[model samples]
Structure formats: structure tokens, C-alpha cells
Target: MVKFRYFPDMKDNNIRNFCIIAHIDHGKSTLADRLLEYTGTLQAFQMKEQILDDMDLERERGITIKSHPIQILYKADHKTTYTLNLIDTPGHVDFSYEVSRSLAACEGALLLVDASQGVEAQTVSNTYLALENDLAIIPVINKVDLPGAQVESVKHQLVDLTGCEEDDIILTSAKTGKGIPELLQAIITRIPPPERDFNKAARALIFDSVFDNYRGAIPYVRVFEGRIEPGQKMKSFATRHVYEITEVGKFLFKKIPTQELKAGDVGYIVAQIKNIRDLKVGDTITTLENEAKSPLKGYKEMKPMVFSGLYPVNSDDYEELRQSIEKLQLNDASLRYEPETSEALGFGFRCGFLGLLHLEIVQERLEREFDQNLITTIPNVEYHVTDRQGNLFIVDTPSKMPDMGDIEMIEEPYVKAEIITPPEFIGNLMTLTQEKRATYVNTHYLDPSKVQLIYEIPLSEIIYDFYDKLKTVSRGYASLDYEFIGYKPSKLVKMDILINNEPVDALSLIIHQDQAYYQGRRLVQKLRSLIPRHLFEVPIQAAIGNKVIARENVKALRKNVTAKCYGGDITRKRKLLEKQKEGKKRMKQVGRVQVPQEAFLAVLQLGDEK
Candidate 1:
């Protein structure tokens, strides 16, 4: 048994750059763990499940939220050594942007499918993304040892997905280590190595970046055209800012400093980048002395599909929150935010996310990593509003919308959604989409048991509780994938939430006129339930401009003033009661209602309960 070793003169032809792409919980991370063990990257004492997943949230949820890059050495035939760089990508739809970024840096991908579950929605979507990137794909059927494994059936589906012959698919149980050696052999033979060109001008693509308090922004790059070394002055092709490289290294679960990085290498370059903003992800880094003529066809900017307001629980911490968000933005290029103030929530940022899950993950990271407590308002989608003045503007928050009297048109983003599920739930799915204002487009049978449903639906509808309900209707067997089609005109109005006649800007929403009443009523009722009773009467009203559509009052707490005058004269008691009533009226005039955080979150689950 020959062990892996680092060879100084490893040829470019011996390098294989690939990524593992699959649906959520189909064992992408598990397979990654096995590969690291087989290649002697980590000893028995150092190995762990999902060793590449660094975040606590990912470990808890058994999911991969971020794309992790790792390098391993594999020795084959007990003689020759090979260098392999593998990027492990997230499988959830919300993190598809992460997958896209990983795909941009690789030359091939392992399209993993579950033998029992067959092909899922994300599997299809990611396979298409890999094809679009012109990546060589090796189809792998994982968990073949399961009792319910449908090896023959899944192989047929992979044939449709990859257009490959049935015998070309590799079957392996990543847990039991079955067919591990065969898969490694297939990778070396099937996937083509990256082309090396050290003679060209040095160019590297910033696929991702991280902020270091000491060194500043450390960019994770893929060397494209030439080689980069320490002490070389490199300038950002996008920003035109120059800096000398301080260090460069690769990660084998941990950063190991290297003297230089050549073409086709994926590693980190530390130039003591201070701002973090200066090293933008997807930007190119080139040598100032001999710069590349053109930048790599980089990744497209990922547009956020959902928008929400994130405010600090304590107003004094606003500045710290801003700083924390900026640092987080360094790691997440898909996360977008801007300074925004709400009359009710005070100063905060209006953040944009790829989806609701992305928003939730960011909030968790902020709270955990920065120790910042945040209040998130109702999630909404960016809308295009044409005012009465004929000016078109984007409104991500309801507070930014003009009054109903402005008399203008509005457009909301729409998505073409694909759902794969068993045909038994067709009726329930139809009803579910109907309630969400989804238009039926087409349906096709993937095989005999699975049916693929396509619908054009508003982006807003799919952001909320839809994924949960989708699973419910299909008995946890449904998978969804969607893409933004374009904006479509809709009759939408801004519904405001008021507490004691003062509008709560954070709780406002832009809803279709037909749904404004019902949704507003549900939201108002939820607020009434979540808010505690105050000394003064608090009226929770959902209104359109001035006219109230739904109202719920939290009755003021009362103290028995008459209890003190047990046997007093009737006139005396009446006088005391009148004085108490007058005092109560004055308190109502000057009093402020302290709404709890739960009230702010009520809008998220307004439609969840009956």
C-alpha cells in the first residue's frame, strides 16, 4: 500500500479539479469525507463526519450552507502521485449561488444521485448548471447499500440527466467504502486535468473572500492564466488597486503556507487587504508589470429574491450592527444591504437575500458570530413602482412606497418554479398553487412514478412557508427549484400596521389588493396575540393609508380603585371613579406601546396557522 505524498514537480496533467454536486442530504459531504480518508489527507484520529463543514449551523441542520475547498493527494498503482482539488458545494436552492461560484472554479463535477431517492429537483438544476459551465461530469449513485435502493431505476434517470450510457454510472456506498478505489480510478481517467500556462500574464479569479482582523481581506482565488508568488505586485482588474502578495497557501482542512501558486491551483492569497471591500468576489487579480489583456468571464451578480428589514434590538448598537454586516458581506457576495430607518424600529438595514433560508442563516451568523441581537421584519420582494410623475423606482420595503393616491402601476417579480413529486399528490398541489396565485404552465412525467410540475408564480409566495407545505402535500418527498423569469404587472397596495394609531413601518407590507384584507386581518390578529397588554389601551390596526381594514385591541390593564373605598358614600365612590377615568385618559394620550419582538415576527407566520 503506497501512501500519498506531496511531490514538488507534480505535472499539470496529473491535477484534477472537480466538485461534488447533489441534492440536500444525498450525502455530498459524506462522500467528501470518504475521499479525504482514502487519500491519507487525515489520519484515523483526525477524521470526522462532514469535516469540511465549518459552521455550527450547518452541523446542526445536517446541511452544507457554504462551499468548502480542499486539496488532497492520491497515489495510484503504488507508484505515481496526483494532486486533486475538490470543492464541496451546498445542495439547497437558496445556496445555488454558492454552487455557481464553486462551479466557476472547477473543470469537472461529480453529479451524485441517491439510489433510493432517485434524482431530485436540485440534482436536475445543478446538473444543468454544470453543463452550462461546460464541465465534464461523472455520475455517481450513492447509498447503494440501502435496502430500498433502486439502482436500475436511478441509473435510467441519470441517463436522462447526463445523456450518458447506463453502464457509465458509478455505484458506491460512501459510508461502507464500497467501490471507493474504482471511483478514484474513474476520476483520474474520465476527467481532464486543467491546462497550465505559466508563460501568460499572471491572472487569478477571486471566487470568494474573507476578512482577517490582522491581515485584512484574504481572497480565495483560482489561478487562471499564469503563476502568482510572494512579493509580486498584483492589482485588481476590477478595482485597479495594487498590493504586494504577502503569502499564499492551500487548505487541506487547514491552511498550509506555500511559496507560490501556479495556473489551475485553487488557494488563498494574503496581501494584507484591509478594507475587504477592495477584493470583490468574482474580480480578477493580475500582475501590474504584465497584466492580462482581459478578465475571465466571471460570475453574474446574484440578484436577491427576498428583502427584509434587520434592526438591532438595542438602538445604541446600530453602528456595531452596520460594521458586523459589512464584515459578513466580505464572506457573502450574494448578501446585499443598505442603511434604512423605520419610524417604529428606528435605524437599521434593509437586507436582501437569495431566499428566506439565506436571510435566516445570515441572521443566525450575525447573532452568533457578532453577539448581536436583531429583529427581522416581514420578508418581501423587490417591486417596480411607476409613480404618478411617470418615474420608475424600485421599492424593496413597503415604507418606501408612495401613498395609494399616487395612482401609479406596480410590478412584482415572478419565477418559473419546477416541482418534482409523486402523482398521488397532484390534486393537493394544484390547490396549493391556486391559493398562491400560481399559473399552471406544464407537467411532464419523469418516469412512471414521478411527475414534474411547472408553474409561473410570484416570487413572494414561494419565499414563505411554501417549502414546508410542499413537503406536507407530498409526504416529505417533494423537491422544488425555481428561477426568476421577469417582472409582471400586478394590482398591489401597501398595507400598513398601526399600534394606537401610529403606523409601524417595520410591519407594513405590499400585497395584492385581493389578498390585502385577509392577510392583513390574519396579521393583525397575530399581533394582538403576541403583544402584551399595556397600562393604556393599544389598538392594533391593519389599514390601507387612512382607512382601517382590520383591528384588534389589547385591552388596557385595570386596577380596582373602588376596592380602597369599601364602605364610602355612593357620591364619594362616583367622584373617585370619575377622577380615575380622567387620569386613565391622560395616560393614554402620553403613553407609548412597547411592542415585543414576537409581534415583529408575527407577519412571518400569519398564514401558517388556521
Candidate 2:
């Protein structure tokens, strides 16, 4: 085992670092609020629901977008006060990286499950992640006060899933603050303290960070060995940029300055680094004087799994959109945007995201936070294309794909999807999966009423509207989680959209051969409804290379006319009608069909066919 410098002044037994993990809407944030009140960390007047969730977006959406860590002073049964660092994590699968980093910063985790909802897909996924980190998991059933809650049933499920005793599962109603004190006491007594090594160099793991206009980049770190204080010169292991720490503070809804953050403690460090890009999350910070021999493990650069193009509704906002995305990327490292132009949409950025939810959140933030009107293209999954020369290439956009003759094979990403639902929805769920080309893995019974189904499906099949359909078919009882397994060979084709026989590159898509026909027909049908009628009939077609497979027509508005009189009058009317016909032909050649913003978004929600 590697040894590190330990701080003799601070005792490791006094610190308890742990994070709370749960499914969305499982009262995880509510429980965090209750814990703060119970521990007297925040006064009753200062207490707010989801105190850790400070972002306006998070509050509005009723979810945590970023993980927050706070320090609380708790008095144990032995009459001794201990410092507990509680990190509140986002429950969404899109933010799983945040959860993983939070777990890596702690020695224990609070596995909070909703009593009413029982064990959900996210809860199970998070539990396994915690176990992988070797964290001591404390299973707690939340929202027991709700009328529909089945505490015993949930308790049995927890016991079976966690292999912990039924009696060990603590039940709490976050709204009423019941069982909070017991939960707090259990945290102090049951969770083991972090290990310390004072003899080695000072090292801290930077799990999360944010930009501060007044001070600069402030990184929230968990000190695993040694200590950090004001005036200490620290350098990031990954970036190698060094800066002197100006101040260290604990997050108490706001920043609260502390003397020093020692081993096993979590707090924020304000350095002179101005650019947020320099302060990388998941990087280790060690003293410049005696740097740690090795950085802490599990540091990885975040890569986006989904790619989409964001064009400004008004072309003038292109620069504004670019600047806005740059500022947003400071807060969200997962976001990747590069300047791109489309033939139909003009100037925009091709942005990459972690998942569909991530893509939506970024788009929503761009619109709401930056006040920019944007047009987003359909989200696409990264595909692997192998050429005839045995070279592999990643295709993120349809236009980037190589020629069919040059490409030896094409592979699309697949994920291991886990769905937890009521037994009644099994047949419907199966049908939905089968339609999406999902292969069965296995099924397990959580209890007499609930079932967990596993399947392997292509990532592209669900990227658009799978979750919405699942919730509809399952009657809102089903919850799902998925992780990318790998890429598999697929028979895929590029489906293109044409307006007036001219192919629109922005509207083209690379889809499976089996889905090409249906997708093509649906897109054309939707486009015909969105594109306004021109002077002449406009034909919208879906084509594969040179062959057209589906077509729809937007009929032109007719103009009322009256002609014919006497024999000489009829000849004059004929000449007039000929002139009108020539004019109409000229108008048809010059006039361009305008497709509205709704037309582009309409094709995104072609849900699973019933």
C-alpha cells in the first residue's frame, strides 16, 4: 500500500464524509434539508427545501443539477462533537458522473430510497456505484408519511437488494422530520472515518468546482492526506497549473471561511486562477513543495455521448450563442461545442452532451439563462464506421459519414437497459422493447408486485422518445436506467429529406435500414404539414441516395379567376390566361418554400407505434 503525509494535529476519527444517493423525487434533497436542521448546521429560519440545490434551474425542475458538499458539526452519543461532511448528489442518470465523483470523495454513502416508490432503477444503479467505490452503504427509506407508502414492502426490497438486515433499514418521513435524529446518530456511529497520512505530501481530490466572478475559480475538494490552508501553493496533477490558495471555506448555503481544511475534510479552495478551464474537476491538488507521489485514482475526462447542432433562430445571435455556450461550459464540463454551419440553418455550434436529458438541459439553459432563441437539430448518437482500409472513424453527424462503397461496416452504440416496473405492464413493456430491437437479458422479481427487466438495445432507438413512451405505456410506474455496453454492427442507411427535389442536408439522418422506410414516411408527412404552401405545389420527398421512398405534397392556394365572353373576348382572355400561367411558372421557379421552426422539432417525437 502507498503511504502519504498525515497531519498530526487533526484526528481522522472526528471526520465523517458521506454522500446521499437516491432516485429522482425520492426525497433525497428533502432529507438533506432535514439533516441540516437536525444537526443545527442551519437555523430553522434559514432552512429551505433542497438547501444544497442552489441553482435556479434545479429549483425550477425539482432536481439537483450539480452535487453540493457541506460541513456539519454533530454531537455523538459519546458526548463528543464530530465534523461530518455531507455531499448532496444529483439523482438523475445523466448526472451520474457527479454522483460518482461525490462518492469518490467520501468514505460512506446514505442510500435513500422512497418508501412510496420503493427501489427504483436509479436507486439500484447508484447503490451499485457506491458499492463499487467500497463505500459503507446506509439504506434509509424516505417519505414514510405519505399515505400510499408501503414501508414493510420497501424494507423487504432493501434488505434483499442490500443484503442488510431488515431492522437496519431506517425509515424516515422527510416532511415531518421523523427518524432524522436516529439517522444522524447512525451516520456518526456506523460510518467509518477517513484514513489519514500526515508524513506524506498534502493531497486533496477536486471533485467539483465553480467559477466566482469576485474571487476566481473556487474548487471544492476532499482532503485525503495532509492539509490545505491560505497561502499554500497548490498545483493540479492533471493541468500542472500552480496557484497559491487565498482562502479556504466551507459551503454553508454560502461560503463560510475556515482556518484550514485537513485530511478527511471537504471544503472549497479559492485560488487566483481566473479561467474555469484551468481548474479541472476530478483532478488532484497537491502541495507544490512536496507533491504526492501519485494522484488519487478514478480521474477521467468527461466525453459527450450525444451530439446535436444548435442554430440561432435569428442568425445575428450566432456570436451571442457562442459566447453563451462558452460561459455555460465553464459550469458544465460535459458540454462540448464547436462552431458549425449548416446549409439550411446557417451559423451554429455542433454541441455534444452526455445524454438526451443533458442535451435538453443545455438547450434549455441556453434559452432561459442566455435569453437566446435557438433551433436544435435531432440528437444523434456517435457511430463507428470502418472503412475498406481497416481504418475506424467516428461519425457524429450524418453529413460526416463516409461513402457506402468506402465503408466496410457501420456500428452503433448499444446500452444495457434496466427497467423496473409493476407486473401489470410487463407485456406492454416487452412489446415496446421488441419494437425498439431490444434483445432480452433476464428478469428478476423484487417482490410479488414489482419486476425488473434487463435488455440490450441500440442507443439510437431510445435517444429520441423511448422514456416518454415507456412512462405512458407503464402508466407512470416504470423507471429505467441504461449504460453504454459497446458498439455492435448494424445495417444502417442514410435517409435524406428533399424539398422541391433539392436535398436538405440539415434534415438528413443515418438510421437503421429497417427503420428507414417508416422514419422517412413520418418525416415527410410531418414536414408537409409544417412547410407553408407556395405559389405552386411543393413536393416533399424522403430519399435514400438517388431513390425516393416516400413523398408528401403541400398544395398551393388557388386564386379565383373569371374568363370568357364573346368570340373576340375569348381570344383576349386566352392571351391573359397564358400570361398568368407564365407568371405562375416564373414565381414557382424563384419562390423558396419556408419551413418553420416547428417542422424541425415535429420529427423528433415520433413515438413507438401502438
TM of each candidate vs. truth: 0.93, 0.95
Give candidate 2's total backbone clashes.
9
- Give the worst 10-residue stretch by lDDT in candidate 1: 1-10
The local lDDT score (0 to 100) that residue 589 gets in candidate 2 is 81
The lDDT of each candidate is: 0.87, 0.86
Q: How many backbone clashes does candidate 1 have?
A: 0
Q: List the residue pairs that clash in candidate 1.
A: none
| Candidate 1 per-residue lDDT over residues 488-531, each given as its tens digit | 99989999998988888888888889999999889988888888
Across residues 475-593, which tens digit of lDDT does each residue of candidate 2 receive? Answer: 99999999878999999988889998777778889988898998899889888878998778889999887889999999977654333444565667777767777877887788787
Q: Give me the candidate number with maximum lDDT.
A: 1
Q: Which numbered prediction scores highest in TM-score against the true structure?
A: 2
Q: Lowest-scoring 10 consecutive residues by lDDT in candidate 2?
A: 1-10
- Global fold similarity of model 1 (TM-score): 0.93
